[model samples]
Target: MKMVFRWYGTGNDTVTLKQIKQIPGVEGIVWALHDVPVGDEWPMDKILAYKEEADAYGLHLEVVESVNVHEDIKLGLPSRDVYIDNYKKTIEKLATVGVKTICYNFMPVFDWIRTDLFKELPDGSTALFYEKAKVESMDPEELVRRIANDVDFTMPGWEPERLKKLSPLFEAYKQVSEEGLWRNLQYFLEAIIPVAERNGIQMAIHPDDPPWPIFGLPRIITGQDNIRRLLRLVDSPSNGVTLCSGSLGANPANDIPAMAREFAGRIPFAHIRNVRVFDNGDFIETSHRTSDGTVNIAGFVQALHETGFTGYARPDHGRHIWDEKCRPGYGLYDRALGIMYLWGVWDSMGTSRKGVAE
Candidate 1:
């Protein structure tokens, strides 16, 4: 596996590209033009500037975390064709700078919901927490106000412009059933996957955060069965998934390792993180060790290794530790620790496989 790190450009992120290059085994950056308005064709000059910066640090800008799908596309509106055409242009531009995979999601309104951004852990370090009861009790607008606390940097899916139009957007999605979401996603894939194939870019759809419906929004990409149906939607190698352990692991029923094995070739980008789920439907992001969280981090890594995965992998979201003042989950400390843990498991697995081969 080729490990990558998520790096928001120069001023937008606390973690610097120079710091990212120092992380052992991290060869690439999972990035995007976060400032670019959703559905607009990315400025070629701006795209090349990011490449120049990563190149300066000897890092490959190989994977983009997201190029968000506009609500028009998700809502199956007539304007979707216009946005999709722009999306195709963005894909072609990204290929110019050697981006191999584009990781995007189809979640309506919110991308990932967390009741508390800095919930205190037993170790005194804090991490992102999800309270199911809180989700049930609060209004989504209130939740939006809470999550959009940081005015300086914008979160990928929670763009201020989108959230500001929440009422109409929510109304637009009210008629969309789970099947309708699937059809909409199929329409999107059928339109873009061929463009991605032509450019050698794998279009990887990230699973719905928490892997279930939230706030009355219908979620189609939640489990293994949906993944199976998704692969069949376009039936091309360019069409794939960015299997995220923490998102799917929130629901204990998901067999993450098995999904990794089953969708072996289709998954080009892997987001490896662990979540500690409580009996009451709450969860907290934790250390990457399998024992530290409910999600089997090592097992997921092994599944990738055994399946002959040669794609990009990244330490998804890390906890806040060591009194580090950084982005909630995208900190430098715990994520670097996660990478060491990943390398430990990955190298041992490779050694064991080689021992058998020899």
Candidate 2:
């Protein structure tokens, strides 16, 4: 696997590219123009700026975590065509910078939900926590207040500008069922996949954060069959998946390792992280180590090795460790630690395989 690290850019993130380069196996940065609003066409100058920055650190800008999908596109509004055209232009711009994979999602409103951003674990290190029942009964306003509570960092899905109009947004999605959302996503793929194919950029859709519907919002990208159906929707290699372990692992039914093996070549990017799931349905993000959480990250990487997956992969949300105060799930300390853990697994597998071959 080609290791990559997620960097929020020069001014936005505390973790510098210099620090990222120090990680043993990381060779690329999964990035985006976070300041640019969704559906707006990205300027070539801005894209070039990011590329140059990565090049300075001897890193490749290969995968973008997200090019946030506009609600218009998700809701299939009349204005979606305009936003899609802009999205195509953005893809073309990214291809110019040698970016091969675009990791975007089609979830409505919130991209991912967490009950507590800095939920304290018993070990004293804090991580992102999801209380299942709390999310089920969460008031939209309350959720917004909780997210908006942290003004320092902008949460991905909960754009303050959009969340301010939560009532209308929820009302808009009320008419959109799971089937309707699927059709709209298909519509988006049909329009953009050809452009992506032409440019040699893979459009990888990230699965819904919890792999299930939240507060009546329809979520389609959760299970293996749904993924299979999504791949068949456009039937193009450019149309692919991001295959995040934390997202799908929330649902215990998903066989993550099997899914990784099955969708190997089709997967252009991956977010590998572990989460501890309780019997009561609550879950919390943990270290990349398998023993620390429910997700078998070691087995998952083994499957990736077996599939000969050379695609870009990055450690997902990490715990806030060592008194480092940053984004709740994205501290440099634990994630850097997680990378070494993942590399250890992949390296051991290589050794074992070589021994067997000998």
Per-candidate count of clashing residue pairs (backbone under 3 Å): 0, 0
Query: Model 1: residues >4 Å from true position, as ranges?
Result: 351-358
Model 1: ten consecutive residues of lowest lDDT: 349-358
lDDT per residue as tens, model 2, 309-339: 7788899999999999786687799999999
- Assess every candidate by TM-score: 0.97, 0.97
| lDDT scores of the candidates, listed in order | 0.90, 0.90
Query: How do the residues 1-358 of candidate 1 rate in per-residue lDDT, one tens digit apiece?
Result: 8889998888888899888999999898999999999999999999989988989989999899889899899999999999999999999999999989999999987888898888999999999999999999999989988888554576778888878999998898998988998898999999999999999999999998888889899887899999999999999999999999999999989999999999999999999999999999999999999999999889999898888888889998999899988877989999999999998888887555543211
RMSD (CA, Å), each prediction: 1.8, 2.0
